[model samples]
Target chain A: MRIALLGGTGDVGEGLALRWGYHSSHDVVVGSRDPDDAHAAADEYEATLDAHGRDAKFTGFENAMAADRADVVVLAVPPYHVADTVEAVADRLDAGDIIVTPAAGLTRDDEGFHYHPPSAGSVTALVADAAPDGVPVVGAFHSLAAGRLADLDADLDVDTLLLADDESAKDTVAGLTEDIDGLRALDAGGLANAAEVESLTPLLINVAQRNDDLWDLGVRFQ
Target chain B: MRIALLGGTGDVGEGLALRWGYHSSHDVVVGSRDPDDAHAAADEYEATLDAHGRDAKFTGFENAMAADRADVVVLAVPPYHVADTVEAVADRLDAGDIIVTPAAGLTRDDEGFHYHPPSAGSVTALVADAAPDGVPVVGAFHSLAAGRLADLDADLDVDTLLLADDESAKDTVAGLTEDIDGLRALDAGGLANAAEVESLTPLLINVAQRNDDLWDLGVRFQ
Candidate 1:
């Protein structure tokens, strides 16, 4: 499947692109506002693959162009930019195309970090609202750490929470998420579960920060 | 240091008991509402140590008795039981004896799970309010999953967030948490950060539940 990562120059985008390029047979494409930056990141990732003696299938393009050509487009941008990014690429997204969001609207204050869902409720909902009709928007990958994800040698037994109103789109993204070697995609019910999934990231970060020697904390359920 | 597990029969208690017993010279005490249950858990844990041929010290008692004898008491109960449980054990606790809570209060609706801070604010604050005056309450281990922690074979490079108003108590618990193998401790400021740390668990669970194969999802920082 053709997968385009919007904001592919960011930490999460790079991680997802590298993992798909190295471990799966999918054609990975990097999309950015700056095509040159996207091209540079793509080249860097390819070099890392070459150094590891693996075949690389990755390319770079502008966000709209990438979204226009890809079967799956992941909005890997930050929470603040999610709506604008989706709106920027909305015209290029067509019917049956899946757009996945890992972004969660959050704010850091005197009371540490808290979920600050936008007027649309969440970043996931915001994406759904921004996309054109018939383009399915599925919320996923909101709890994974980019550091562990980007490392090919890192053996991850991690779970990625998925939420969406659309069942078929949810399944498609879930299939894509699980295909990357060690990841498992579980149904966290639907779009209502997005806040629960998104809020975990800050809590994990706080735990990792406060505890010594536990810098990169991960959860594993029984 | 003397350490007490108020809910030693549960997953987190078992993990803490095993790690501390195996790695530290500290005395480990198992506590439960049922004295017999505490004794049984202690015996089972002792057998685990005996299997490894490591003679680490452990004992069993009722919750109040265990708290009475310990320097630090850990409330390892679920979020719902935290307040009543603390109230039950309050008379037994004394000044300078620290209490720690790892519970995150959560509410799940059609829209997913969220950090449902009581009107009193975060769970840690709730715990502190329930405790008697002069008893230092600290919040740690808000995001560490019981499954990963109980598995000795799992090499978890994870973090534990520490939140406390008292510097000395926070430092002490921070040292204790890092004493466990492959766990790191971080200073997350104070109890103000409790909501952020506590909220991570449900989000992680939601993510784990939604994904295929990603059971017991965890985080690791870059």
Candidate 2:
């Protein structure tokens, strides 16, 4: 499968790019508004893969061009940029193509980080509303720590909750997710439950902040 | 500490009563609308503890009476009943007393369960509004599985997310939570974040429903 990481210069985008590029057979395309930045990030990802003894070719493109050729597009943008990112690539997505959102709305106060969901209820729903017709949106990887995921030395026994309205699209994304070594994918019902999945990101961050030993925490269900 | 389990005949109430009664030195009081039911449930809980070779005393009382004597009151009632349960026990809660809510609003469909938060944003918030002034409300144990908690034989490595505005009260509740063997309590922030903690319940249920080996799943952050 070909996977496009939109906003591919960001932390989450880079994490997904390196993991998928190193661990799986999926062709990874790094996408950004600036073609130069995308190419730079793709070069960095390729170097990391090479250090790990994997020779993987990563393509860099403008967001639209990247989305146009991929079977799956991951909105690795920040929460506020998810809708616009999806809109920018809307014309490129086909009916059967899958869009995955790892973005979560979070607001911080004196106490700790709290979930600040979009008016559409969740980032997944925001992308669902903004995407072109017939393109299915799936919410996954919301609870993962970017620092932990990007560290190839860290053995992940972490689980990612998957949510989507379309079963086939959800299954496709789940399969892609499990291909990353040691990461388990659990179906967390349909799009209506996206808020629950997205909210976990802030909760995990808050927990990590309070505990000394629990830095960059990731959730595992047993 | 004296801990009261409101709606003590219910699944959650029974699980908490059993765990606290068997694992900690705290006094466990079972409360219900009906005194007879409370007494019966308490006796059952005592018998279960006895079979496990733990000699623990359990008290049974009406909801109001239970709240009057306890230092921490746990509202183990369902989401719909949370407000009324708090209201019924409102007059009994003295200043500095703590009220804990484990209820999560859930609505199910053909696909699976989705979070249906109350108009107050979360059941914890609803109880906070209904409780008497100065009675601090803390949200904890929102994501624990009742069956796993009730089974004394099953070892728990579960983490319960705690949320509250009152720092001292939050600390008090956190200390109480760690008394239950194998349960670690993580401070998840203030009551504004309760929806995130509550919503995790249904998300866990949905994930457990879809996965075969994930029966009675519980979360551990690593």
Top-scoring candidate (TM-score): 2
Alpha-carbon TM-score of each model against the true structure: 0.74, 0.95
Q: Write the per-residue lDDT of candidate 2 for residues A28-79, one digit (tens) a residue.
A: 9999999999999999999999999999999999999999989999999988
The interface root-mean-square deviations, each candidate in sequence, come to 4.5, 1.3
Candidate 2: misplaced stretches above 4 Å? none
Over A108-131, each residue of candidate 1 has an lDDT whose tens digit, in order, gives 876466667888867888888888
How accurate locally, in lDDT, is each candidate?
A: 0.82, 0.91
| Per-prediction DockQ | 0.30, 0.71
Using lDDT as the measure, which candidate wins? 2
Question: For all candidates listed, what's the TM-score of chain B alone?
Answer: 0.94, 0.99
Q: Candidate 2 overall Cα lDDT vs. reference? A: 0.91
Chain A alone, TM-score per model? 0.96, 0.98
